[model samples]
Target: MLSLLLVALLAGSGAIGVAAANDAEREDKPGGAATSQGPRNRSAFSNPSGNLSFARQLDFKLGDGVFRKLWVAAPSSTRSSDGLGPLFNARACQACHLKDGRGRPPGPEEQPSSLLFALARPDGSPDPVYGKQLQTFAIQGFAAEASVQISHKPRVITLADGLRVTLQQPQYELRELAYGPIDPTTTLSPRIAPPMIGVGLLELIPEADILARADPDDKDGDGIRGRAHMVASPTNNGRQMLGRFGWKANTASIADQSATAFLNDMGLSTPLFRDGFGDCTAAQSACRAAPDGADDDGMEVPQKLFDLTVFYARNLAVPAREGIGAPAVRRGQKLFSDIGCAACHVPRQVTGASEELPELANQVIWPYTDLLLHDMGDELADPGTPGDSRDGRLWRTPPLWGLGLTRRVNDHDFLLHDGRADGVLQAILWHGGEAAKARDRVIALRKVDRDALLAFLESL
Candidate 1:
């Protein structure tokens, strides 16, 4: 909040000279508090904070190596990068989060890559056979958990102005079960990779600041109820903390998220997760017995490499806003608030001091997210429970800072958890439950107003 006030003060003092304008412009950088825009092109998503120290920049590059390094099966000379999959979805972190942007669901003629199937039984336990995530790939001499086939059922929704939008409803079928037939009642959820920009700033946002936005019981009775997701902290010995990352806000810290990704996405073990046989349950004997590439440090990914990767993920800058001063974008910004979108997508937050990464401390940012979970109703709900305080119908409000650059960075505009929504409007049309009123407001808007609203989102 103080950061915003400083920007306002500088704007008010026109006599302060050119330096004031430059500082105001810097404040407008979208990575917010830590905005770093580089070259303004397809590679815009990849950069450390512009304000980062020279020493820290070297660390960022080191982490980038680990993020993009390809892993292999054990018993290879490349022990540092070995221990890929007994069962896994990808061989590297960059596979899903390409260029640190979002991952899309497989197209009709393409095989699935970045998308993963999270499997669970009726009582929220991992499937007895496939474990937690279905792995379609395995190392040499190992059997993958299963093969997944996806088909889409087309559906249409008409807005108030007679605009008909077609939406895809994905249907998944598990085939070629490596461990025999799965339980008939097993549930599945699709988790598409989210863009990795300004997450470090999100991590630094004070818990008190986030909690202050929560209206768990809708005490004001505005028909909007948002609550923080409490999850077991893997780094803190399972102590409950506000969940900040993941589709359901199922993880508390960036460390947990990075560690989990290494193990779950790549089947590579880290100090936090010592298992080289990632996601392979006891029943999957062949997978568990697969050779492990534990280095002298005793984990597939040593502590230093693991920490470096997390550092890389934590500092990916948010792309700068484009055309913020345009008339349509200005109008859209107002309508965004008028339609109640800002209630959940709060525009401004200030980070508390951070001893670990001082660059992230004490800055104003506009990430346009509350980082809280809200029930999105039936249409958006997944088939399975996500975690504690999370069910089929709830999801964390994703930040909108770098949203406009999604097309440039990932080369596709697919959005939402499953990459089902073709663009921003469709994503809004799909909103329900707490966002039902916002959806109705957008539907009733005049075409001009709707266009302006979209323009405002694009400016982000």
Candidate 2:
């Protein structure tokens, strides 16, 4: 995931242009200083496995025997499929996430339907018009389930001196629903495709590594405590698990997450997800007209496709940093530690046995997150929605590895639950809940210090 973001951000300027950092100006900043931390500890974010460039071996990994060999074959797109949906967003997984990857946020100059997220739920029901994902396309001969519209709501931010600035939010609109309106209390959170890199390793990180860092009560009075958020498996298997994917932190594993993407995002399916009934409402007969599952061209092929996808995402490497080379970046790293940003965005971790792949076993990865959940307080809470074992506002501390690459990958720097910020700087400004202390410290820093800290994040 971090590596994907880094590529996107680094290559972003091509479509637009990266605002070059003024090295001299950065060096002059007081807080963005250099320190002799002596070749800082190796960042675990980098892929500890070997090279991970794109390759046919990565693209294909067919297995043995017709049954177990499902582990090596690709799930072919069939005319009438097993895991597809009567209601779905795209025809292929590569559509929204281009290359089984990241996407550009919808915005000015971008195709109206090129980007999709911000789904709408009517007054009381959980279903969405274009089936739950606010879809833009439809199967041949079928009318699109619904369309999406956007509006803006502005709120005032008051300064210490009473100066106020308006913050405008791009509101989501659901054009049509097959059933009733969403409950007045219903809330929404927009999500998009995140990188598929390193997820396997992330899942492999021992649960103890996660719990050892939990301090939900803020025992030290640092006011920054973290917890874990476990959501229902949705495989509907009655198993609740630590959420490892999605902005809402809802998915449990690459397999489940991948199956969801296949069913919800694209109208595809695998043996795992037999049908596309996810967003289908009981009232939508057409959407549910198919059998329990979709096509079967590759129903048996999921094992292989999923494993490689797992291998790719799990072992994709993090770019090696030459050690916060600049003085300002170094100071920013220290400030990051001193201020407790590291508390939740913990710096490092080692991967466990892959049992599946020998190559990824016992690897050390620096992902910058403990993969736990935390309450971000009211300022960031999505009211009306209660969370898991934690509160509604809690979110997994996202890994910071390739955060700097947001602009490149998605073409915009929207961050948080609904793309609330445009850059790391703005995202930091929006932090609350357990990390409020760290957020306050960031605001209190002088221009130089703030820049240094940001430099540190950028350097990540």
Candidate 3:
């Protein structure tokens, strides 16, 4: 039965093609034509798509400039860079996503820039006082919303071979409240900045293909029920579209994600989120009265600059896989599929057509995510919202394309939505609900097989 399942998975992953050698070679380039054959260092995630035209190279560079550009308080002589914050988290996109990689949780004494807290009431409305997110930074003369502190409680799990793995259960506390006391019913969700590789390609994945894999009712009785997160398209005139980005799969497109980050993280106005006083509530009159950095068009980030930034985000390339054909990696790969990890982290997806970005269109990519929401069980659940049916238990399956390079790119191996897991193994162990069986299988694996499984993930 296990052998049959392995064969079925291999066939589904296109690993059993007529030209097996050719297929193996193709797997090494997980991003297809867009994969960056790399310098293989800290700058690995910073490259443009491999197939991007030379003519468009300058545009990508300009977009990088916009992403790394720092913001300041309004009324400054640097007209283009002003409009920072009444209350915000980071000054630039790069501040959180340093080197275009993952964001780490801040140390005990450090103030958070990349790890942010999102606040929502039971009915999916912003907190009445602190607004949608908690901002730790404020412009001069303004009180910041709050100070965030994280502490961990140790949890040790003994595996089948009696190998004990310790996991840190993170605890978040808000201190130094600036505005007022938060409503007791508000739910706080901590989010780490996810890596920004192959996002454009993810956007190009056909909605039909994604929905085709969703088993919301679990009709097959596999206990893995992935559901599509339907959200209103911010740019498509309120058209409901598949939600593919963010920890909760709340945002629908790369453009929307970029615009949202500009507003919430940096307190800069974008075309999508037009409010210059980002995250400041109506109750906070002082924040609302603060001066903004809007230009003649009444926007902080103008259309041209916003377009460049979004383009840069969309074009960031996925690095090519390293050491894919090694004996351990091959074993690990087979084990990964056999253990049911691929049920949600479906390995292969072909991007749909895109005339505007031809290089990304119709390419086979290995993002290792079904891009659907799943019940992650109680351990990882955020505080429940009263009227929300999901009750904060469902989380989007983040892509695993750049799983191996976390240490090189960010100098840390913080994983998962809250950066609670210290490594790949810990992240997997934390899985529950639909992934509970897979997690148990991993725990039951012999040490060698477990190591092989991790090796396969790292080769991704």
Candidate 4:
């Protein structure tokens, strides 16, 4: 808890900045911690004042060897299984996730909805928002490559004084058709890759608290009840555990998260994800002829590769909080707690014991999330593959550190689970399902009050 609180203050270059403002695309929500707007963007601040050096000591900082391994732009291959992906996104983990820690939208100007989560139905049809992440280049005779970039549509909406805020929706488009049409029915959806700091801390939280935060039965009668989403914890072997990572809380651990990313992002296979090959539906022919991860004999490549990649993701540092000493940001911090954002986005959490990283053991931390799933409302729904109950309208509340530098890190600034907004503000605007009331309350605030809210978010 102490480490987390200190991280909130601006210490030095090691620390990150506090806040910034948003444009019209964020009209639905407010701006940063400091602004010409309302309430001085002040909010109450709560942080743990533990020894910073001690916390860092416990951190599993990735070594140069592992970090270097990840930056290769090519995956490692074993004797039997060659680094695969006749059908994949990029050659290495850092391709789309650049710098190993940030996600940005792709448009002339960064907008929400930029980071993309790619997937196809069992038969290879494009999901609505995500046209087709279909792989273009396979092995030698494989397909060309799936198109992955964003396109935009311009729009004009005039305000009361005839001040027109022209904006672009920031849409993703696939180019250079490779093989056949996507199955008319494949469900497609894109989500930004979240930063890796504090994730290990999140993974260590006792599931009891996570599940305890849920009210799946809505017994609270707040119409905003949230519940836990259960998924397989890669660390738990075949055992299923409380889902924690990913937009939909679909993945269970850093390793599972890495495995999914390697296979889907690069078409590489690991022991956990033995097959990099995808099932080709009738509509997509290239997929039919694709190369798969072959374990012909032993499994050395996948084993070592997954281990290092997992280390890289698991050890990344949570950006240090810089410039948090500003008076306005502090005020905005108070307002943040006054509002219920802290309810679902629960502020302080302590990690369970850990053998791998002693620094991770029993130390309290501030992750600002309940690690539960909430229904969010129709305004934000992508209907992205709708079988899971809590998740169809829900998303795990992503951590808020390092946001000020998302652009610097990932080179873009699209927020939200599915990249629905141009900035953090739009992500707030899209909060409608169980959060409709909270959103409406935020929208009703006067101009200054709204700016204050936005400030608080930027401070995150």
| Per-model TM-score on C-alpha atoms | 0.93, 0.73, 0.95, 0.73
Tens-digit lDDT string for candidate 3 (89-124): 999999999899999999889988889888888788
In Å, residue 92's CA in model 4 sits off its true spot by: 1.4
Better of 1 and 3 by TM-score: 3
What lDDT, from 0 to 1, does candidate 1 have? 0.83
**lDDT (0-100) at residue 299 of candidate 2?**
51
Clashing pairs in 1: none
Per-model root-mean-square deviation over C-alphas: 4.1, 10.2, 3.0, 9.4
Q: Which one wins by lDDT: 1 or 2?
A: 1
Task: Give per-residue CA lDDT, model 1, range 246-352, as digits (tens).
Answer: 99898999999998988888888898999988899888888888898888877999999999998998899887776776788777877887798988887766778
lDDT of each: 0.83, 0.54, 0.87, 0.53
lDDT of 2 by residue, 259-301 (tens): 6666565555465765545456566666566443323443522
Per-residue C-alpha lDDT of model 4 across residues 121-141, encoded as one tens digit per residue: 544344443233544345555
Best by lDDT: 3
RMSD of 2: 10.2
The order by descending lDDT is 3, 1, 2, 4
Q: After aligning candidate 4 to the native by TM-score, how far in Å is the CA of 184 from where it should be?
A: 2.4
